[model samples]
Target chain A: MPDFDFHVSAFAWVPETSRGWVKCLRPRWAFEEAGFAYRTTRLGPGEGGSDGYRAWQPFGMVPAYDDGRVRLFESGAILLRIGALSDRLRGWDDAEEATIASWVFAALNTFETHTSRLTDGLPGAVEAVSRRLEALEAALGDREWLVERFSVADIAMATVLREIGETAVLRRHAGVSAYLARCLARPAFDRALQAQFADFDDSRVA
Target chain B: MPDFDFHVSAFAWVPETSRGWVKCLRPRWAFEEAGFAYRTTRLGPGEGGSDGYRAWQPFGMVPAYDDGRVRLFESGAILLRIGALSDRLRGWDDAEEATIASWVFAALNTFETHTSRLTDGLPGAVEAVSRRLEALEAALGDREWLVERFSVADIAMATVLREIGETAVLRRHAGVSAYLARCLARPAFDRALQAQFADFDDSRVA
Candidate 1:
């Protein structure tokens, strides 16, 4: 793909706290991992809800993708599509693809749901998060990645675990902590995170 | 698929409130719409955490699917895989497929997230759910479905909305209410819901 041939909606300005961790980086990482070239179309987070933005993403979220061939809004869906572009990051078989996708959904919905409660200071919520983390730790036993290799499942689940980042419960699971470390150490993730921060800085300068 | 060739792990007994509307119904609905044959494997919800179940679904959740060719968990991922089986419930082109996928994500993650608060009775939550409902209402504007046709997006979304059936916020959006009605009216959904309920009934008897 040529420069600007494919456009992905990115936050023109994410708050400083969420700078390197915005949802947009999932697809950026996928693009980098798959070595697919693309460009960002920045819009304010609030502008995400505007009619123009909603045309691409109905819920007014960022990281929608478009090219001559396809337009997609969900970052998970976008990452899956990008994975389809290169065999480097995913399995070629139907069973393999389904396994990878199942983990993606688990990361986003199940594991991600618990992250919301890790810092809420409610005993019930804290317990809920702990139970989920234990389950994850058990599943990851002696494996570097969720599946046989580092695929979109890694990109999705690791991104969610990345949000937990040395928090109280996460600190207790040495295996999980090590797993997240391995995921973040990937060069593709480093590039994506760097670009996200760089984009925020450039937008501020403008 | 032969007898027991494909297995969907369903609740051995879902509570009466969730019987027909269990998460398994999403794939069941998808399989029905696509007219693919499959079978269900029953296990208690807690039994879902057993070694055998955990091998298939890490989270011990119901609605895990396995054919000789594919095994998938996560209702959303399962529905997407089913959509791939036949264009009967999805778009033909890449762009169209992306459009359908975006709505599926919006339904499962965005819209479904807010539904958790509809009955929580917290002023803040109630207001948040209301806001999301309004956005969904605005997006639906005079459309029969999220995209031009009834696809897995509808199966995924309508299933979520059905969870909030006749809630305060839902009643305000007659369009969404009617959309759910239209979705439930589909023969595929009716068959799926009935089978799910029958599964529960059979388990109770056994």
Candidate 2:
């Protein structure tokens, strides 16, 4: 019942492997980097399926955000909103901001879109994911980050790459693997991952 | 070269079926809605694979944008930059802008991601698309556009829906079908569609 400036929705618990892998970590990482204090509203059993939750999150997905004035869903959108509100995370200029947006889309639409389907164990999915990873590895080249500096784009991309971290397809790209290591090395990322892991119940380990 | 205020990348030619379906339509539609006159840099064969094009567009995809000041790739990102620049297409307020961003991600990450995979004809893919489409239909109840007014969110969603327009999966949702029709009925969409089709050669009819 406290008047928290920012509130992000998450699940009450997730399986063991999914402990720190929830999409909610995106917002949590952003908030940590921004040095912002925010509260989390964890959904109970069947809450995500309720009509009220649907009104907030059209797809019953977690990581929806409310910033006192507006409600926003989609981790990519929420990340952008967080960047806009946080001085530390925002780009230096409008053009830099556009670059950030471009990388965000690349991470979600271009990369995650393919990586998410790999679990299906389809040949086509493997090929598709491989093609995109090659492009991403090429895109990364020698740049330390997706944009000028560490931003939400890296947060998005790193999380996506982490989801498929153990795959040989991703392991082949040494530069990408190194890049992921650098991103995960950030203290903020550790804070965010631990926060999400803390929310899960040890009794329910899937 | 003429000093055009804005420029967008596109393919010099695509197959007949893919003519209007090219993602360049997204930016063209946005420009039309904004009443902005922009030039198109049509990529000839092998150009998308070139190092220069890759520098501008990491994935070497079409619909990259340049406004003399900054360059950006990804249709969703380009749409957002257009919204920021155009008075007509942008949200009325900052909060409304956040809403537009949310829907844009929903269209690209949520909907297009699944629809794109359907061409592979995987069962899991079909079920995923159906679930998301049902949510979309339910969320879209009694609404003409994704946001308050017709914005880039509509452009992204409309284009994504149109890609799967002929599929029974999409057609099953009456509300979503009507929404797609409403979006296509726009003069800007028509203009953008024809503009893309005009760029393709008649000989390539795939």
Candidate 3:
């Protein structure tokens, strides 16, 4: 056990829902795979409030992490930290490691940037995101996963794609859709989704 | 020392010239500080055509890095990797490291987003960016730097802010202007800027 608890500041519904969900989910799965005992603290809408959260995160964003030794705010950085703790997410070699890191950024910065803009109500956002999806599908053409096997990059990207999966835009992209299915089928992802959604609905009702 | 040479794809310009310029300058300084040999492959101006440098980067963006180990894209990710190579940039401890990492994202995603929009030539973009500059000025007020001392976050932000600093809108923020001045004073920054601009006139003449 690493003797660390992860605290995530997130909202149930927002443009960043998928990212927030993944932040709460991936570490828990990795920790479980490592057989490490860890707890998660989920902040509610009014519980942390805007000012409180922004003070902790100047960007006023959610999915911040507080490991026993350090507090990390970016999901990518948190994911990288978690990946460092175990061999399951990172590669054994330097070249592989750099590739994994590049894909991680591509997932969040390149792909998600365009995807989020689509969902955020920009002009022709849907069309733009559809083109990006086609690009991703082409990138993933025959591969079951992005890198070697199912790594953190897959986890991070699938989580982001889940937001758009509900739309008709992604329906045409069979490879990406199948990849997402493979990701969600994992027991840990399922459990985490349940827990996250349960808390999400609880907040809405509250 | 690390058995690596950095090949960066960027344009030649002053720090305050634009977002792309600032992004390229910061990590160039970091590499210089690390005593690494590097080459800048400049792109010519077009949607994705920059002086015939398009093939070097997949996304056709400035500041893509190619080390002997692997090619890495995205300015934020590149900065994180370079900062990780040394203890000087990571901070005194893990806690400081996490804090600094969080602020790096804040600068790129939050502050830089607004500032980029302000310079994007849209209506009200100037005012929108000015407001962000004021908030950044307030955040940076009286602080010699963002973290325990001058760190990668400061370097990343100084580069990004340099673009906004060139505009009349951002120039009105005294604190930010002063911060930019302080950043330019560093010898590493001077060398990086000189290197980036060394071939500017020649390329223009050609």
Candidate 4:
């Protein structure tokens, strides 16, 4: 119900590739699913010059959000703000919410660090992702999801995992592969993926 | 007020050289200042081993905090939770608060990265810190503090800067040096420094 606008740096979405794709695409999916009205703008690369996408982010990054009142830059911060605005994302109690917050930080700061290295063509990308995947597998041991039922933590991690979904590291983990399927089963996530990626495929062929 | 207890694993207050001295020391300081009862535990290097700290944090990092209700890691998240509980740290308004949040991320992710490299005895530490110092100096030009008034962002950055306070990089910027002094002027910060480093001076003789 709260008015929101997001400005993202434009990229040809590869369904799994691109620098800011996961950050730019996922929250939009979550917001629309929560039945919130929001507008999105994609700024071309270097369109804003030195300011770049920082017009939307003081820190000069993409995936910035403005809710008419507060403008937030960090992707994790923006996701937290959106979760606070919607009942669909947060957990039932403060403890659950705090736990989810821990996982969110872990997903980005810990897990995603390995993921970033993997994507950046670093030497140890495969080994690093393998270690993280093993950890995620152990954490998910015999469980369907990270916490009880589905929550924002799942969304956050899934977005990152989706980046390396095609890699052998994730495919080898039966639980993680199954979890990815469950995340995509959500009609909201499916729709967002299709809409966001459709233009990229079209551009590539042209 | 939230009927919570904080269990903090920290180094025994030395004086100035405690790792995570600022973060681990501040909440306790705030709690004591607020008349809240809490428990403190000390963990020494090589005493707990790898699994010890990593159990609380996958990164094997320090200054992890656990409330009876919910366990939270990451200083930024801990600070946000503490700020929400009390208004002592939030800035003048929502925008200012948002600015404070960006600075918190910037300090840790951007400024601290360069500062850490500078302190880590790397080959290019000096050049890296010098470049970052110039950038920060320009950003802080003519401003007394990061924002109009002091907030937690200042606390976070001041603590990070303490790691390299004695470096020539900081010495080169008169404004940054003055800014750090202003942060240290707070009685709370002074007590934190004392609690953190009092033992280090004696250890030198040992």
1 or 2, greater by DockQ: 2
Q: After superposition, how far is residue B105 of candidate 4 from its true place, in Å?
A: 3.4
- Candidate 3 local lDDT, B1-206, one digit each (tens): 45767787776433334433545776788887666777776655453443234334445556778777776666777777787775566678788777777767666655665565566554556876676666567667688887768788888788778766778886798888898889778898888877766746443533
lDDT of 4 by residue, B122-172 (tens): 556688667656656766768877878766667767877878899877899
Question: Chain A in model 3: its TM-score?
Answer: 0.79
Better candidate number, 2 or 3, judged by DockQ: 2
Worst-scoring 10-residue span by lDDT in model 2 chain B: B197-206
lDDT per residue as tens, model 2, B95-179: 8898899999999999888888886676677788889989988888898988788899999999988878898988888999999
Interface RMSD of each: 1.4, 1.3, 3.1, 3.1
Which candidate ranks first by DockQ, i.e. highest? 2
Clashes of each: 0, 0, 6, 8
lDDT of 3 by residue, A107-170 (tens): 6666666576566555566876676666567657677877667677777788778878887777
Off by over 4 Å in 4: A2-22, A50-56, A118-136, A162-186, A198-206, B1-4, B11-38, B44-60, B109-142, B159-187, B196-206
Higher lDDT: candidate 1 or 3? 1
State the displacement of the C-alpha of residue A62, model 3, in Å, after optimal TM-score superposition: 1.7
**Candidate 3 overall Cα lDDT vs. reference?**
0.67
| DockQ per candidate, 2 decimals | 0.68, 0.71, 0.38, 0.33
Chain B TM-score, candidate 3?
0.77
When just chain B is superposed on the true chain B, each candidate scores a TM-score of 0.90, 0.92, 0.77, 0.77
What fraction of the reference interface contacts is present in each model, in order?
0.67, 0.73, 0.37, 0.35
- Report the C-alpha lDDT of model 2 over A67-169, residue by residue, as the tens digit: 8988999999999888888878889987888889999998899888888888656567788888888888898888998877899999989998998889988
Tell me the RMSD of model 1 versus the true structure. 2.6
Count clashing pairs, candidate 1: 0
